[model samples]
Target chain A: MRFIHTSDWHLGRTLHNQSLLDEQAQMLETLLALIETHEVDALVIAGDIFDRSVPPAAAVSLLDAFLDKVIQQLKVSVIAIGGNHDGQERLAFGARQMARAGLYIQGPVSASISPVRVDGKHGAAFFYPIPYAEPALVRHLLEDESIQSHQDAMAALLSKVQAHNSNGLPKIVVSHCFLDGGSESDSERPLSIGGADKITPALFTPFDYAALGHLHGPQYKGAEHVRYSGSPLKYSFSEQHQNKSVTLVDMVPAKAPDIRLLPIKPQRDVRIIEGHLDTLLAQGAKDPGRDDYLMVRLLDTHAILEPMAKLRAVYPNVLHLERTGLMQERSMEGPGRERMQKSELTMFEDFFNQVQGESLSGPQKALMSDLIASLHREAGQ
Target chain B: MRFIHTSDWHLGRTLHNQSLLDEQAQMLETLLALIETHEVDALVIAGDIFDRSVPPAAAVSLLDAFLDKVIQQLKVSVIAIGGNHDGQERLAFGARQMARAGLYIQGPVSASISPVRVDGKHGAAFFYPIPYAEPALVRHLLEDESIQSHQDAMAALLSKVQAHNSNGLPKIVVSHCFLDGGSESDSERPLSIGGADKITPALFTPFDYAALGHLHGPQYKGAEHVRYSGSPLKYSFSEQHQNKSVTLVDMVPAKAPDIRLLPIKPQRDVRIIEGHLDTLLAQGAKDPGRDDYLMVRLLDTHAILEPMAKLRAVYPNVLHLERTGLMQERSMEGPGRERMQKSELTMFEDFFNQVQGESLSGPQKALMSDLIASLHREAGQ
Candidate 1:
């Protein structure tokens, strides 16, 4: 049995207030082509189908169109589950009816687990889906007071799956969780504040392959059977260095599975560049990184007039700008409360220099003194 | 052929800040019972299934449960359309897949409108759904620039339906729009500010029956076959006099249809009452209108203390209160801006008398004067 493993689509996501819908649509087009070329039997989407619980209408339409092409046009079975960012009830709305079209979605943890069994050349391949659920919900569902963390919840769920699988078919476990030793990124919401939500890879001892989602980096644990396919697009500057890919797994009965990574190229790459304003502009004139979304940091010590507008003239997609060297120096200094206790005129001058990176002119200082005198007169009256 | 015609469910609607979800659930229970008792072959929901384009999760769950029972358990077909209040794209999502389960939801109007044909005891019953579409959408869809008003759009849709029916069948037209001569209510959003959306009832001459929505009053338009079944519950104080009901139609081939009204009783009745404060309080003490949601008008000439709270002490569901007589008298006078020109002491005295319904005592008047002096001193400083 061969299947394509992917997760964390995060449809309707925006980077620095810019919509990624177009890039997301292009990524899905590439995915469909890969599925056709590989001739994969089943598709596994672990979790996080949407960026937020309530997505905008355009996101809903995009998902609808994508599913129609994959399930109805390609005629492949898809197994999906809810992630922490998903509203479980919303995702599970029409699961029963959609199941007829080979779209299986599980939202909540149930006491009795059912595996979607698919007949393959190596016999029946059983796919077990464990959707994202809170410890409280798992505790309530199992009526077990000892389930206090995500690790405990997964242990209980795996035990149920173990009890149900008496046929000993080639088993695969699909889940949305933060496995131990997986790299983290700024965009992925941590399952818990502390590290209490991490689960060990050993929980899948009986399964041939474990397809995991949560981290934004495509990687494996100590063994090669368990892997994270990662998000298809970079969602933050912290993920700019990571190559996004989907995992393709080939499994045969009573044998180890073979895993391969198929890299996905986004429509516009997210890149970071740092230099003085003049040098950056000269580089932009030569290369003109107009298509890539960019974050530029100015290394010049002095202030530059409207640097963002100037850089955007060449790089239209520049999303963020900052004076990193000056900012770091300012952070090392303590709070400026004593300076604020001085005369209002001095305080205004300090604020002006801090923001614009220049001291007040003689004329500007004279105008400020006049305004302060009038304010004192008004108070005296 | 027999069918139940209902519309403007306005699920997730609230009245006077009170959630009507409980009442809506009860009303749906009654509707299901009626569907079974009448043995209706199909259920027609004309439009406005939800109060807003995006409903809360609970409202979605209620609609889901209702559809599950009707389409899955009872094996009845439902044909629905989008209204002006609905988001057309959202309502049309997954419509093609859902059609397999006998749930047909049409959002935008198209040139080729297909009928959901069901064989009845008499003949084949053809149900054509024309969802709510603006003039601009209709013009673009048909590529006819002449379409301007809603009447023109409806006329174009009906003509298409006329062309499609080559054989003699019992035809039923389902739509959501404002028809001519129908009574209006506050809760029913006006399709247009000046009745520009009113379409003549003669447009339905080609069909055996027209099941309409949009008007919250259950009434016919010059003929028995063309009707608005109204909403199943009163959504506003202005609609308190209406007897909420659903229309049941029995049709046969090439003949006039038989229409009947099945009244639905809500869990709590919305009522309005008028009397002096003391008389209303006494009445409330005896009858204790705790079950009914009430609106009260106090006819007393002077202000009363905490009338809303006092009334709610006996009638827990009293949602609104008004001093109608005094309020009317006050409005008859000119703007209060003129009274503000008087001395501060005099202004305070008048305000005290108006609210308390009596002049202040000597000690109270002295305290007010002293407080005014202190305020003036503070302002000077």
Candidate 2:
């Protein structure tokens, strides 16, 4: 079966207090274009359909529209699961009834995990949607007190699903959980207060493909078949470098599933740029992508008055601004003081290099050493 | 067609800060039993399915379970609408898909009001689900700037539905809105911040039956065919004297709809009892429904310390406590001074009667008047 695997839309999320609903709405159009172009059989949203447990009314309306277009307009099946950010019960409202209309929405963890069957030209493949579940909830639901960690919870859940899906068909498991070795971003809310939330990818050895979520960076964990589609948008500055995409999986009975990553162009890209204040503003005027959400860093040695206000004239969407010189000095005054573990001269050299954005010349370094030595001699006297 | 028409469930509602989830769950059981015994053709919930726009997750789970039992297990169709208290889009999540499973969830006001047909032994009856719409929203949706009042909105919406249902079948209109002449209670949330939210019942003349909601009292408005089922439980102290019930409607071709009120027994009724704290505690031991939610009024003139704590020992669910003597005295000192419209001597006599819970005898009345006259003469000197 051919499927477009995506997750963590995080609808209703705001960037630097700016609403992303409009951007999200535009992104859906791109998603629809991709689905239509690729002629995708089914759309599998692993988790995080909404940014919060109780999302805004507008976000709810957006989701309803998206589902209507995909399931009814496109005549494609959709299987979505609930993420940690979602209230599973609320997410699964009318889920049972929606399933009849080719929309299988799995929410919360249950002992009996039913597989949604999707038939493609190759054959029929069974998809097990294992929604994000806390170990405590899984422990109680499965009656397995030994499920102490996310690892144990995933293992128990997979085993239970395996018991139900003994048929020799290509099995696909769609889930949302922190997998060991998967990269994380600031926006992926931590699942537990204490640690041990990561589950090893080895638990999905029996399944042919694992479409995962929760981490913002799209990557394979431990195995190629086990991968994260990542968030459709850059939810945080930490994920600015990541290229978000939707994973398309074509699974057949005989061989390894043919996986392809279709890059998605966000409505507005998240980018970080660095240069002198004047230089960056000039660059912004000429730049075609000046409207993108931006984090600008000034490299000038001297303090610039109202640097953000000056930059905003050209770069209208500058979400963040920083003078590296001032930030470095402030950071150095923090734990960096003890963390330095270097001689006073070396520390001074590092500070000078940071402020000037260049290392001191050899002659200047020697002159500074001589002055430091003379000061030491005078203090001793 | 026979339908168990109900509304204003307000699931997840709390009575005096006490969670009513268990009570709501038990009420659902009673609702299911009635549907089974009556062999209801369809279950119609007019509106106000939840107490708030965002309900607790547990409440969402309960709703899922309830819908599952009725639509899946019992194989009964359900038609529900949205009320002013509901977030229409969120409430109608997956509504389109759910419609295929015989679960028609109508949310928000729309120009095209589709009829959900429920077939019975007599014939198929079309039900126009006109969810509650603000005058502004109705004006915008219908492109009618003249829709300036609830009366105008209802008239416009009903006219639109009438255009769609010209066939000579029995027509029923299920909706949530204030109807003129309908009895109301404290629990029925006002539809508008200002007034003029009531729609005239004359607007429903085209429909054979009107299953209404928003009023907490089960009564007809202007006509017998137009009625409210009331809520399944007493949501406030003012509704303590009101009998809560579900409405059953039997409609056939060319006939006035047959309506019956199926009185619902609450899990724990809301009650207001007046007596001395000590006496009430003694009576509580013999009262079989002592566990019912209560508003206690202490008639004793003496100060009672920690009356709530004392009452809790017997009536564990005492939600409110008031000493009438103290309360009456405080109320009299306020605007009562100017609004009294009574002589001081007469006010004193009324106060004595109220405090002592008895009318003054002829001798006592004479003594009070003589004492008041003496006080007046002394003050004048």
Candidate 3:
């Protein structure tokens, strides 16, 4: 049995309120086409299907359409989980019923193990669907009451899974989790570093194949079986140069797993070109892929006027623009000081002086007294 | 095809901060059981599955659990849509893939014609889900640029469905809406009284069965096909006396549809008992169904001491409490002149006298001058 692994869709994400729906739609469509061409048996979406708990209406529609095309039109099974970014209950809604039609969704983290077994030539492979589990939640589920770290949580989970394995079938675990030794990208949300939730590679020893999500990079930890398929599209400029794709895994006998990267075509490519505003716009306008989403780093000596507007004339999806060299000039102007009053500064100074056991000079005393007097007058008025 | 029609579950709803989730869950469970006993083919959840656009985590879980039991355990096909209360896009997310499992969720008004056909031994029935559509959205989708009113929106919707009916299968249009002739309870959120989105009943002339949500009451809007199934649980005390139930319809050929009201057992029955505090407490304590949610009206001569505490001892779910009658004796000890200077009555008298073109008394003028002087002094200080 062969399958495509992908996760962390974050469908309604906005880069500083810029709409990514058009770009997202195209990216998802490209993945769907890959599934069709690759003849993947199942599509594993490990979690964060939406960017926010309450995704924008447009994002919902795009995801709905994408799921519809993948499952109904293409006749493929979809195994999904709820990510931390997702509202678990919403994702879990209708999951049970949908599972009957081969679209399995695991939302909330529970002690009970749910395995989707797909028949293969050799036998059947059990796909364990595990949603993102917080350590506190695991503690509550285990009823140990003392488990506090990510390691403990993973231990409890792995123990439960191992105990419940009545049949020793080739197991594939699908989870939305952060694992040890995986590359940290800017887009991937850090769950924990030194707490109970920080799981190590040793905790995942029971599974034959681990199809992990959450981390936006395609990488593996511990063994070849554990892997993150990464996001279907590049969400950050840091990821602009990275190849985004779904992992096609074929599980058969007498073979080390057949794994390959199936690249997703961008609806519009995201390119971060560093140059002066004029040169960047000119380059964007002349480029054939200008229709795609682009992020520009302006290396101009001075700030350009309406840079987004100028860029949009050619690249309508210019979602991001950053001034690189102009930062020093902007910082010289500093932030507006109206928000903070002199009295607030005086209060901080008085507290600081008190903490340091410091005495003020005659001129300092006079200045402080004058400040206090003005503050009192303002309060009276 | 036989099915149970219900809507406006509003699972995590609150009436003045009173949690109705427990009651709602009980009612939904009862509804599903009735479906199983009646051997219903499909379950129609019209809309407003949630009270808020961003439902709390608990609400999401409740809905998910219910869906799992309905679709997985009972093997019932569910056709749901978004309502005015629902964020259409959020509710419609993953609906396409879920539809493969016979859970048809249609949230877009433009896609109203996409039907989920349920083939029964009798014949085939098309379930057309039309979620609540706003007029602005209608105008945008239709590109009319001038179209307004829900009546117009629904008219456009019906036309699309009509055009898509090449098969001419027996159609059931499930909608989340309010219609003319529909008696509304206080629980229903009014889209508009007679303005932009007010829908008239005449627009729903092309359906065999219209299972409507919203308007929290079972009401027929002129046409027999256009009917609101109402909410499963009593949302407010206003609905306490109303027998909440799931509408069971048996679609049989050569016979009028047999509609049966299946009663749901409330998680906590609501009873409104009126009496003096002492007697109310005594009677409330003696009441056999003390465990139920109570709305007690205390007909006290004066405010009772810890009335809620006393009532809550017996009825833990005592959410509604009111002082039926109380009167305060007016004070007459103050100096008339001084009292008048500090009163709104004096201000009213001045306003009335000015309107009547009457001159102020010398004493009144002196008092007014003194009052202005005091105000100015306070402001200046």
| Best-fitting candidate, scored by lDDT | 2
- Model 1 DockQ (Cα-based): 0.33
lDDT of each: 0.82, 0.85, 0.75
lDDT (Cα, tens digit) per residue for candidate 1, span A1-381: 888899999999999999999999999999999988887888899899889877787987888788778888877778898888887666665565566677788876677686888764334588889999889889999999999999999999988777775487777888999888889998999998889989888886666888888888898885788888999889999998999889988886567887889999988998898988888888887774566889989886544557899899888888999888546545555566322223456557766886888899999998887787777667662
Q: Count the backbone clashes (under 3 Å) in each candidate.
A: 0, 0, 6
Model 3 C-alpha lDDT per residue in residues A277-315, reported as the tens digit of each score:
777767766788887677777786443456688878877
What is the Cα-based TM-score of model 2? 0.86
lDDT of 3 at A245: 84
Best model number under TM-score: 2
TM-score attained by chain A of model 3: 0.80
Cα TM-score of candidate 1: 0.85
* Predicted model with the maximum DockQ: 2
Write model 2 residue lDDT over B108-149, tens digit each, in one string. Answer: 877788888876554577888989888998899888889899
Question: What is the C-alpha DockQ of each candidate?
Answer: 0.33, 0.64, 0.47
In model 1, the clashing pairs are none
Query: Each model's TM-score?
Result: 0.85, 0.86, 0.76
lDDT of 1 at B235: 91
The CAPRI class of candidate 1 is acceptable
**Tens-place lDDT digits, model 2, residues A37-153:** 888888999899899888999999999998899989988899899999888889999899899999999988787888899875546778899999889988998887898999999
lDDT tens readout by residue for model 3, B58-95: 88878877776777788888888888888767776677
Give the Cα error of residue A74 in candidate 1, in Å: 1.4
